[model samples]
Target chain A: MLGVLGGMGPLASAEFMRRLTLLTPAERDQDHIPAVLWSDPRVPDRTAARLGGGEDPLPALLRGIRGLEAAGCGAIAIPCNTVHGWFEAMQAATPLPILHIVDAAAAELARLGVPRGRIGVMGTAGTLAMRLYQQRLEGRGYECLVPTETEMARLVTPGIAEVKANRVAEAHAPLAESARALAARGARAVVLGCTEIPLGIAAGPPLPFPVCDTIDALARAAIGWARGA
Target chain B: MLGVLGGMGPLASAEFMRRLTLLTPAERDQDHIPAVLWSDPRVPDRTAARLGGGEDPLPALLRGIRGLEAAGCGAIAIPCNTVHGWFEAMQAATPLPILHIVDAAAAELARLGVPRGRIGVMGTAGTLAMRLYQQRLEGRGYECLVPTETEMARLVTPGIAEVKANRVAEAHAPLAESARALAARGARAVVLGCTEIPLGIAAGPPLPFPVCDTIDALARAAIGWARGA
Candidate 1:
């Protein structure tokens, strides 16, 4: 069975599960894949941890990973994009196959035949700072573009915050503006690197460039892995 | 930490977690209650099993409960209302505190101070057949009203099935009709005894009397227990 190591923000985790269900080919409950979710929201903030200003989320993340493994999960997926900053560490710590959100996004980009230049990335400060998307996509011969520091600080971060606070409607304008800015900067396609950004942007107007939601990518990857196994 | 014995229908389980997060007063992740969710959608159909034509869900339910207990959850909450038909048996097999969904609904009824007679109940055929809501509320001095056999077969059952099939919008009309019928039959308040009912009915016209959502009531009860502990 697959496991979800979640609750980076509870709603995102919940949304991921909902997407997983919607993506599965099932007519009844039994036809769907089984999953174990360890939703311990107490894990410290990923942005704070990555910035060296708050408690590290590693210990809590490891605890959740172990809990899912103990429940007999054969593979695991962490839905939060920012937490993918510690992808290598989490992978080394667990023998089980770990589905990386960034890798999934990169794979999706390749599958969609998004050209190898100027792919936009939008997410939390921690995700951009760690170069999670850049490192993964660049190694695949793609250049990544991100919102300006001012936009990240003023628009992207607050947009994600609004979603976490359950004010999804309020987050749309800023997120749309940021997406527009990234596309105007010559980004061929934009990756919604944060989970909350998808929810906010989904309710708003459509973007000019192709948008890839990491949450959907990760959920699709997990479903494919589970179904294949 | 609380353990969620879920995936009796996966979306309902996800909704319960979403509600748990929303009901909590936490401004940050750490202040919210921690939960371990085993969303094994492969569990045999509760309605089919209880009716004696399908595989029993007891073994799977027991396994989920034990998995959570092994993970160090102090109490367990099963989000599905129909599963409470086996609450006593589940509680007897495990030492962990098991939160009862019906009791939570009854408590909400009392808290709302609705006069104790002719409370309408709508849910899966199995939950009504077992009198899961009736016994608990009747003990507290409230009479129960369920859809007539024709209504159950024609409107209520199909409406619930539609929601489970993710056709929530289509379920609205039939469910609203059921609620109106119950109210016209002298039901002072209608208890959405099934978790799916709330999702289906939310989009429909407002009911004539007060509506009690068992899923929300159960989530509130679980949060209260987790927080108080």
Candidate 2:
């Protein structure tokens, strides 16, 4: 059974579960993967703590992992990209494999037939600060494009914030604007690196450029692991 | 924090979480109600046991209840209507308040401005057998309309089974046929008592008669409790 360590923002985790069920090749409830979602929204803001003086979210993350472990979960998946900044520490604390969102997104990019050229990465400021997607995807031989500080402040950040506030339709303009900007600058594809960004993007029109949704990517990864792929 | 005792068929529980999120009048992630979904799909079939020659789900249910209590959930909501047959026994085993699905459905019927005429109740055989909704709705001065054994065996049962198997589109026809029959028989409104029914209903055309989705009703009740309504 998979353990979903979520509520890093509840909507994303729930979306992952919804996507998991959709993506699975199952004929019945019994054929579907059995999982537990330890969705404690009380876990302190991951991006805040990583960016500066917010309280540490490590203890809470570990508690979720241990709780799922106690519940007999064979593996774990945390749907938030910003929180993956703590991935190493969290993984070190548990024996179970925590599916890596960056790896999942990279694999999804490949599956989408995105050439190994340029990829845009959009996420919470903390995810960019930690260079989460860039570092790993770059290692996979793809050059990364990111939002400028002005673009981040003016469009991406506020767009993600609106999604967190449930103003999904309002979030699209700014997020799409940023993604379009990245595409104009030669980005082959844009990674909706933050979980919130995908919700924001889905709120409005489809992007002209090929794009990868990390939530779906991570969900596919979790499904793969569950199905022993 | 709200504890969702789900996975009485994983899809329904996940839908409950989705409905809970959508119904909440929140402007941001923090403003949404905090919840943990203990979605263990391993619990034995409720309908099978009630009809005889099947394993009892009590011990598994009790484990889930205690697990939620230990996780510091302030209240509990079980989304599956059929499992509510064990409501008293489960509630007796926990200090945390378990929200009643029938009461929530009754209140929703009132909120929707349905008159005190015949209200249809559709659910798993166990829920009907245990009189989970029938007796309670009857007490509220509402005439209860249930599917005949033929309707249950032919339409309702197979439709629900398809939903459990994630064949939502296929489930729609039989389920809709059942609802139309109920409305033709003078049902003022139908309470989609089974969690899976609403999903099936949503897949196809909308019902002419007013309908109350127990999942949404139950979610509203959870929100009410969380917000002190």
Candidate 3:
């Protein structure tokens, strides 16, 4: 069984489950992956905690991890990218193989036939500050492109805010504009590093260049694990 | 937190989760209801068990209920219809309020303003044989319409099987045909008693007759409980 540690924002997590179902090549209900979604909205904000502006979310994150482990899950997937900032600590706390969002994105980049050119990584300030995608993808031989501070302040941050508020339609233009900025900067492909960003991008028209959605990427990873298990 | 006792057909339960978030009126992430989904497909088939053809699923159902209670869920929603055949035992085993799919459908009927007419009930053989919806809705001043055994074997049954197999597109024609047959027999509205039926119906073009989806109805009930609590 797969455990989804979610509700970093509720809708993104729900969309993850939906995508997980659609992406699985199942012939019957029994053939589909069995999952337990520990969706507690009370977990403190992952970005705020990482930025030193709020209470630590590690305890709550650990609680969800323990709960899923107790529920008999073999492995776990966290849909929210910002939460991956605590990946090492949470993974240490649980014996379950907690899938790394950045690793999944790296695999997706390879799957899309994207090579060592500049790759745009879009996500929360915490993810950027901690160098979640940049460090890993750079080590994997891909140069990373990120939003400028001005762009983050005016576009990327608030666009994510809109998605979290369930006003997904309103989030599209700003998010798309930020991605367009990356594409103009000569990015090979932009990764929707945040789970909510994919929902936002999907609300509007398509992006002109290739974009990797970590939500779908993570779902694919979980499905791969389920199929193999 | 709301508890979803699901996986009686994994896709149906996942759709219930998707609808739960979409149906909730929220401005921010926290405004959406907190939910824990226990989607274990290993529970023996409900219809087979009720027909005395398989192992009783009561133990597994009870286990899921207990797990949700331990996880701090206040109320529970079981999306699958045939499982409600054991609703009494399950409810008796747990103090938490288990939302009834039939009651939700009945409320949806009132909400849709379909009052005191012949209502069609479509579901698995266990649900129809047990008269789950008919007994309750008929007691509330509505006559019940049901598909004949011929219709069940040829149309409704096969259609539901298609949905369970995740070939939702293939399920549409036969399920819609069964509903049309009911409408022709003077049913005022058709009730999609089984959770899988709605998925099948929605996959096809819109039905000309009024039909109630128990999955959405159940989600609404769960949302209402979360709000009021």
Question: Could you arrange the candidates by TM-score from highest to lowest?
Answer: 1, 3, 2
Best by lDDT: 3
What does each candidate score in C-alpha RMSD? 1.9, 2.1, 1.9
**DockQ of every model listed?**
0.65, 0.57, 0.62
- Taking candidate 2, what TM-score does its chain B reach relative to the real chain B? 0.97
Q: Candidate 1 residues B1-229, lDDT tens each?
A: 8999988788778888888877777655566678888899888888888876788889999999989998899999888888888899999999999999988888787777784877899988899999888888887788899999999999998988776776779989999899989999998889998888888898777776789888789889998898689
Error of 2 at B30 (Å): 1.9
For model 3 chain A, the run of ten residues with the poorest summed lDDT: A24-33
Q: At residue A44, give the lDDT of candidate 3.
A: 84
Using TM-score as the measure, which candidate wins?
1
True contacts kept of 3: 0.61
Reference-based lDDT, residue A109, model 1: 77
Error at B152, model 1, angstroms: 1.5
Error of 2 at B219 (Å): 1.1
Interface RMSD of each: 1.4, 1.8, 1.6
Query: Ten-residue segment with the worst summed lDDT in candidate 2 chain B?
Result: B25-34
For residue A216, model 1's alpha carbon misses the true position, in angstroms, by 1.2
Residue A182, model 2: lDDT of: 95
Output candidate 2 Cα RMSD.
2.1
Q: List the global CA lDDT of all models.
A: 0.86, 0.87, 0.88
